[model samples]
Target chain A: MAEKAKILIIGAGKCGRALVELFSKIEKITIIGVVDFNQDAPGIKLAKTLNIPTAVDYREFMNKAGLNCIFNSTGKAQIEEELMLSKPAGVEVIGGCSVNLIQELIKEREKVEQQLKGLAQRRNNVVGNIDAGSTPIIPKMEPPDFNKQVKKDEDFWGKDKLIESIIQNSAVATFVINSQHKVLYWNVACEELTGTKAKDLLGTSGHWKAFYSHQRPCVADIVIDNSFVDLDKFYKVYRGSTLIPNGLHAEDWYSKLGGKDRYIVFDAAPIYDTEGKLIAAIETLQDITERKKAEDELKKAYTRLKEMQNQVIQAEKLNTIGQLASGVAHEVRNPLGIILQGVNYLENKIPAKEGDVFETLTMLKDSVKRADKIINTLLDFSRFTNLDLRPEDINSILESSLSLVRIKFESSNIDIIPEIKKDVPKVLADRNKLEQVFVNIFLNAIQAMPEGGNITIRSYGKKLEGIENGTSRREEGYFMIGEKVVVVEIEDTGVGIPEENLKKVFEPFFTTKGLTGGVGLGLSVTKNIIHMHRGIIYAESRFGHGAKVTVILKIAE
Target chain B: MDRKRILVIDDEENFTKLIKWNLEKTGKYEIRVENSGLLGFSATKEFKPHLILLDILMPDMDGSEVAFQLKCDEDTKDIPIVFLTAVAKKEEVEANSGVIGGHPFIAKPVELEQLIDVIERNAY
Candidate 1:
């Protein structure tokens, strides 16, 4: 080899940079320098890194000793002319079409090299599989050559198949959609979750069919469209995922999925190409129906526990009030008895005639009676001890209560309607106490309807299903579910209790009635008696639409 | 029928005074009043009353102890004793047929006619 040729490139653009890279590997040519007007050109920066000289002007390398060749890739005719005239004697200048031709050949060689690397990788994989005791199925075909470009394309497509299979066999429900919103991949897990085979949904834009009755964008479609604002319109609970960038996680309850209601949590993210352009979106789904049911059950249990705690507090409060009332009643009654005796003695001394003297004595006597009545009622409310529990007919008790209030009903123009069921089961309750309970309830019903409304007394045997007790004071597990019980419902078309006061009716001294209402201990005593029998009593009212009170007691075995 | 003698025992002096005034006004009975159970037990021996109206809850000595002492004496053992109390409810006395523990009981604050009816029925 006569002396190696020292070449200088006139441009540092893409083509010039490619030529520099290609020539740097040639054995017969030495890169003398790279020249471009812009100091930041790609080819100049690369040449500097390789230890080759770089210049802003081609004339700086023109007189360099033994510089024998010049390649002008700038595509500017003025630069080519200057390079040709100023080149050293016996040096050659190549420009225009010749440089363009060389660049094409260099790109072609790069493509061939990439194909050969892919072939080598495929060969190594096959040998590795053979060593792992797996039979290798080699394709029977002609040997690979540069001209067989389709074979190299087929090899790349084989890698795409591997990705497709991996997604198809995954345990999580997954689907993919192209930029046009067409379904591209609906995997086996998606097929099972939606109860729709993959073939019907593969090429169709029917992903919404799985979750909604009408067509709407799923989370994956929203991600592809970059429409984050639309998430609220579709999902009730959703938030951005912390684990994945540009991904969304959401939970929703679908009324009908695979013929049953299902709660699902899903995550969707956009897939981007190497150029950072959004190409498709992938979404995964998980069925959370069982978990949602368990959560609901836990919440209900917590509410029941709170109610039981309140009941215990209420019982203790009632016991304290009872003891206090008992003591006070004993002290007060003695004085009341003495006053009545004094009044009686005065009545005998006075003449047996109607006069101011006689009226004054009678008024004094009546006042003592009133005070004694209040004391008696208070004592009744606090006394929860003596219960003569026996298996007794609830129907007969209801009838007796109705009879006791019949005079009030007739005087007030109220109508009594008894819908007493025959063959009703007997309840384990004290007869007199149960009678008192019904009488108090009936009296309340009578008082509520001052203008005379219908009082419906209905009694029947029922199996408790846990919903019979509507009061929040109900203790959990007090009555076993499905146990036989006697249900007595007394409904009145009276001035219904205000909604806010419904729960407080059973509380002592909680009365809407004024002083004439007998101290508000009637229902309170009634509730104590019913609770002593291990029964449940609650009231429901619609303010002006009248009220209904239900009482449930265990049926005698 | 001769006027029957009645003895009233109670811790409240006003109550015993009121009972004596009311019961004597009827004219069918003469009344003796004692403010303490111990004094009432002593009064029963001298008063020789046909009936004794005893109050159950007294501070110094209750009616039960007074009745036990009176019954142990041969002179007052045969006299009919009635318990008039404020502690027992009227409904409870009526449910027990106006008698409890072998003695007739009357809830206090009794009207004159009802008190007269009970005294006449139980008096010897």
Candidate 2:
């Protein structure tokens, strides 16, 4: 019932023997005939036992047989002699030779695949996602079967045979890592990929030990480091002199193996036992050199697109802010002028009733002062746009900010304990901007503890590192201390910002108070200022446990 | 506890004048005004007012710098100074005022009733 190719052979010597054995193994190709001039040809007995047609003469076999294709495995110097003799007799003769027909099958498959890939590449590549050439209209579905997949997956991967089968059959390296990230199981393909045999890698924490520094045995100058950057989604594709980090099951990473740079894509899935415990990640790896190249191209395009989007967003923000600023100036300036005029007007005119005249004047004066303060704040907002970066002492900045709010702190009976470091290294930043950042953070701290609690401000060099967007690769501290940095942490024993509202603090105009909602510009401005100085700011708080904000800045060269 | 005398120091002339007029209208205290920290320091010695209302942002040295100087000097250290600012950020006001020992702050565009109440509560 199945289709098979009927292949006929014209010689039964060493060539015929090779033909009979190789062609018989392939289920798709059936050897119908093996012919030899000698009765005792090496393959003749074997072919006869297998019930295949045997001929002492090629002409007799050609006269009797009907076949799709013929191979003349017999060695020949002049193929022209064989082709003329065979073609005139109405037989198709392959040029007196046999090569792997499997190669032809492979070439045809490759041709089809190449055409498809070209079409896919042209159809707008958004890697790891649906391509644009996909049909716009979706086919109708019956219903959801969430349980069908998650449940049946157990049957697909049987218990005992799971690890062995997945490892042996996978084209990519398969591995199992334990709790301490030690290699538990290393498959044969891992040997093929990393070139270190399974026996060599087993029980040796080589990946954790020397894999980072030692030059790759195969590909020179490839990054030997294979470690993970901790994040919620820690998957990323790597290339360019980088050794694919072990343990992480990201589809693939770049490594130099076999004397040439190659992309080895592998995924490691963590395996767990009952009671919902995290055991180990089962990893699978593959060589996706060409696929990686295409992916990298797509990633580059995506990054460019993201940058363009950020530029557009920032530009829009600036435009809107400019309009708001001008409107505020217009809206407040006219009233300010009116108040000025009114004060001048009141100075000359005497009201008939002297009792309330002084109170009226006082009200007008206070209102005018209030107007002036608003104008000043607006001006300050605009001027901060042009940051005047300089080497600034954070100690002085903190001291100055505290002084501004000292009166209010005392009146409210709040105890302030400043643990500021003596001789704190000066950071390269705008002094005014730094003060503003501290002031904003300090204000939030004070607001948290309304009844007045202990507030601590601590400063040190290299205290914090890897604060998102703030820490650079050139720095370390665990605050991880790879790149040296200076850090200041401010803490307050007040009601902590809620978990839900913590991230919202950095969004402009987002505030908790209904009518008292500040423009919510404080934290946003603080974040922007720190970013401007190439510094990082991070806040940690537990509900009712208070909040701590850490600012990490590089000590300027 | 006769009518307490209150001294108001600020760079804004209209603000000082307004306080002097309003505080005196209460008929509970005598009011005197100075338009600068330097002038205010001088007035403290001459007038010997019971209470001093200070403005933080002023020419010829700011209010906190003035307060720090006052705290250091023997003559004006005894007198209580209250800071009046239009600044909305409590942290800035706290940092500026907290460093100078104990002090009080009130935001401007301040309600006339709240001003009178604060003045009465803190008066000598």
Candidate 3:
């Protein structure tokens, strides 16, 4: 149904003979004639064999009927110019320089035609042999089945599209790659996670760009490479490689991705052909960053709960001790009353001339005084049940307490540094009890530095940020966020409490100053008083360095 | 001047008797020791003491309750009472000094001189 192209060759040289041989097999074109100055040219001889007419003068065949194209392969500039002028209107004259191009195109066409004819003949021979009731000759070589190969390629792309759809609709980010590490499938989740489109990544080995700034193999590439070497060099915390049912699995924390660090898991498996040959590899990704954050928060809350449980036990123990001490103190005071009156009577009856007898009576009275003081201290600890809370200036109370200890400081050769911020917020506190707390702390600081040292008191008002809970020294649920509070810090440069004894400092009857005639109820009662005022007190100290006590109280609205 | 008559109300018999002998030895006063609150209340009417020394903690009735009873009585209501108590420390008594709770108090284990000094200053 197609018209043939009429063509002529002006040169009868080797290139011309080759072009004739190449174009003779093309069905769309027919060679009309060949011409050269030599009658014995190789192309002229080849044209005779092919049953084509030959001419010595190319101009003779220039305007020949059915001639639609002319090839000037003479290699003479004069002949090409002459052919260019004399060529007919309907004919296209290709010049001498294009002879090589024409030969190359004709050679390619000849090779394709021969292959097609060979396949056609083999099919006909096989059919003929079948009709003759004979076995067909088994050829030494066989041509490839074009239809079967085309169908196989189509089926592969179809499976690829099916896999791509599955990944595209997945909730987790995923991607797939070929054996050469080329990206074959990058899904919608992958697009959102890596901020890179599938269209940009498909058919390219750029999987590392999503999780790394530099060019390196990802976990999928490692599986394909099957080289487990230097995996830690690539990932932040790789759990090594493990074999799953259909793949190799790897998990790690990747911190170098486009700006966000993420925890990722990957599964990669080698895809094989029907012959069990390796063809490609596929991998999937999952991001667990938010899950990790929730886990850390849970751990912190559980630790706080345990600390609160311990503090409740301690508070209950101290409460029991308090109840017992109160009962015993009241009962013992009456008997102590009788002994003191009897001692007074005896002292009056006995004269100073009685020497050791009167002196011994005085000793008995002194012993009774010491016993009474211990009992009174126990009562003080138990009797602090009610608090008279009022809006009082904490800074003023601190100043008054400091004045009460000024004489002790003068006698002890200690310097007092007061850094009180003016206009400190008033706190809801019992003024008498809070002043007693400060007085006890100041006296302890003086006693700690018997040689000579410095005592620093700092008072200021601030908005509460974070408050620690679950300690006996601080009452939980008493402080809230953004509540205005007054903070007082009493730091002393003296013989600091040792590290082992820091937590026991606020416990009743726990003291480091044994030689000093104290019942060890100073800090214990101070802690109780501050708790009554709905405040917190905690101590910090280094063994050789000084001790610091911080007290926090809510400011009155 | 007539020696001042003093009445001591306390649960401890030995304690009150010792105080009675000690004050009488001074030759400055006459004293009566009542070991129970009900008996002490009746003794104030019969003795008509110039000054009363009341113990805070007592059997059958507390000293504060007995003090309220004496304050209501016509014969003993005018007598200035001094509390002899061991419930408070000696330092606490000296810190408040002189009169507290509308009456004078002497902390227990009081010296003879301190006891007589409070009686002379407060007793009429």
Candidate 4:
């Protein structure tokens, strides 16, 4: 064999580094030295690690034995001309552009070599798998060479185009990102979902732009990072997928997708190469905006249905109690009347001058009257009498109710602030019953604030909009959307009802007042009267703050 | 003033008796008691009181039927009938100015003063 050819690379840059690595691997050539102005240049470092001679000055190696060739990679003409003039007689200097061409040819050859190695390995895997499985009978055919077989395999798999086509034509939005977090594939479905073209997104790390207003890692990026523990910090709802190992799923509401609000679900999984190395991550997206809206609507409808069911049960219970109350009233009131009349007779026959006799009879009469009052309240609570409905102004009714309780308010040191709106529409309601409702509410407010507070009564006409829930009121189609209604709100700055008791305030026999204050039927009776008028009544309170009772009645046509 | 005559018609015997005693003790009226609506109607013609204090919800006959019969008659139609019953609510009675069904009404367990006021207003 001839003597080995000694090569010298100049510039110690990327091109020079490629030349050094390539010549070092050749069997018939040896890299004699590397030269660069920068001591820390990549080629100089690599050449030093390979135990080749390196220097900041090329003249140090100029006279070395058998240094026959010099590759100039710095792209400086003055350095090339100087090297050409001072080089030994047998040595030749290749310029920067020519070195570049030689580097390209070498790189191309290495790439082809890597491809052939990979194809040979893949072919072995295929043949090995086929041998391990049960054989299938086939017609005799000629065996192809390795190159032909590799070509056939490439055509059969159509790896890149087939995967891209599958993703592009899929109805579900999908995208893939490599380990460097660069978007490798952004399919047509993804384009439609995000309103971003593939040409602008491919090879970029801007997949987050489709779902978020700011820069952030998407699910696929997180998977590629293998940072699932920090998923909660980025997503409100996220969980590990049950189907795929090392897979994750998350849901979020994006406000700016396609210029519309959308609820999106992301399913991301780590894609591994044949050697079980995580090479990339794939993420599939689903637009669940309509499904989420429907779910919310279904939730509202279920709540309404539950409220109506409770109302029907309450009405039935009240009806049963009413029947029982009427029966008891008829049976018990007659005897009470007899006792009261007897006490009156005894008072008349035995004069007041008798020792404690008139007092005793008065006490007896008082007890009888109290009993009758309770029975009357029970009767009122259970009564379902036809409303003597008439078109009447709500302001006037509120004023009348306030007037009736004015003396109580003053005595209790309570301030009455009437914010009644003028020209309020008339509501078809029984005047007496509605007056009773307001009076009961005012009395409750007064009782609530025995230490003196403010009772604000506000009345206004409004157009009904959406149905309200969880207000101790039933939406039973009594009030239509856009219907005119008179709303009366009575707010009291007193000891607010506790949150737990807010819902029970309208239930029969549920009262915060002690035994002497009331029989727990005041709000129940009030709710009944309002319902009879086809109105809604509900109470709201923040504990330790205050209580507000609102009554809504439809305006008469 | 030949004390105004009043008749008490109620199914409760003790209630009617006490009412009669209480009204007579007032010395402004003479009282008669009947236990049933049917008997009360017959006694109305016999006693010919100035006012009829009728109890509704009586078992034998309802007070409204008794009132209907009295109004249908020639002699008793002129007499005023005041309903003293447990069926009417006091608030409703007061709200309607103590009158219901074209006649005066007083809820039962009534105080003596209110009862007297209603009776005097309705009686001739």
Best by lDDT: 4
List, for all models, the DockQ compared with the true complex. 0.45, 0.04, 0.22, 0.56
lDDT of 4 by residue, B1-124 (tens): 7999999999899888888878887889999999999999999999999999998898899899999999999998999999987866788788789878788898888878878998888889
Greater DockQ among 2 and 3 belongs to 3
Q: Mind listing the fnat for each candidate? A: 0.66, 0.02, 0.36, 0.86
The count of residue-pair clashes in candidate 3 stands at 0
Question: TM-score for every candidate vs. truth?
Answer: 0.58, 0.37, 0.52, 0.59
| Model 2 chain B: lowest-lDDT 10 consecutive positions | B86-95
Interface RMSDs of all predictions?
A: 1.4, 7.5, 2.8, 0.9
| Candidate number that wins on DockQ, 1 or 3 | 1
What lDDT score is found at residue A394 in candidate 3?
88
Ranked by TM-score, top first = 4, 1, 3, 2
Q: Model 4 off-target regions past 4 Å?
A: A1-216, A219-249, A252-305, A353-357, A381-396, A411-413, A420-431, A461-486, A497-504, A514-517, A531-535, A553-557, B1-5, B72-75
Model 2 misplacement above 4 A: A1-315, A347-355, A384-390, A463-484, A531-534, A554-557, B1-124
What are the per-residue Cα lDDT tens digits for candidate 1 across A1-557? 34666889989999899989988887767889999998789998889889999999888999999886788989898988777668887676777755775676576557656655776677678789899989885744322443433333233223454456656876778888877777778889888887877788876889898888899999899888988896788998887653345778788998868777889988888876545567778898878799789888988998889877867877787787778777776688788878888888788777775899999988998898888777777767565457777889988887777788789889999888889899998888888889889899988988898888898989999776665447333545558777888888999998898888988898887888897676778898888888788888999999999999998888988
- Name the candidate, 2 or 4, with the larger DockQ value: 4
lDDT of 3 by residue, B1-124 (tens): 6899999998888778778878898889999999988898888889998888888877788889889999997877898889987655565567568567777888765666788899888888
Candidate 2 residue lDDT tens string, A393-426: 8888889988888777777667888787787778
Model 1 stretches astray by more than 4 angstroms:
A1-309, A389-391, A427-429, A465-467, A471-483
TM-score for candidate 1, residues paired by index: 0.58
| DockQ of candidate 3, scored on C-alphas against the true complex (2 decimals) | 0.22
Q: How far off is model 1, as Cα RMSD? A: 24.6
Candidate 4 displacement at residue A208 in angstroms: 4.2
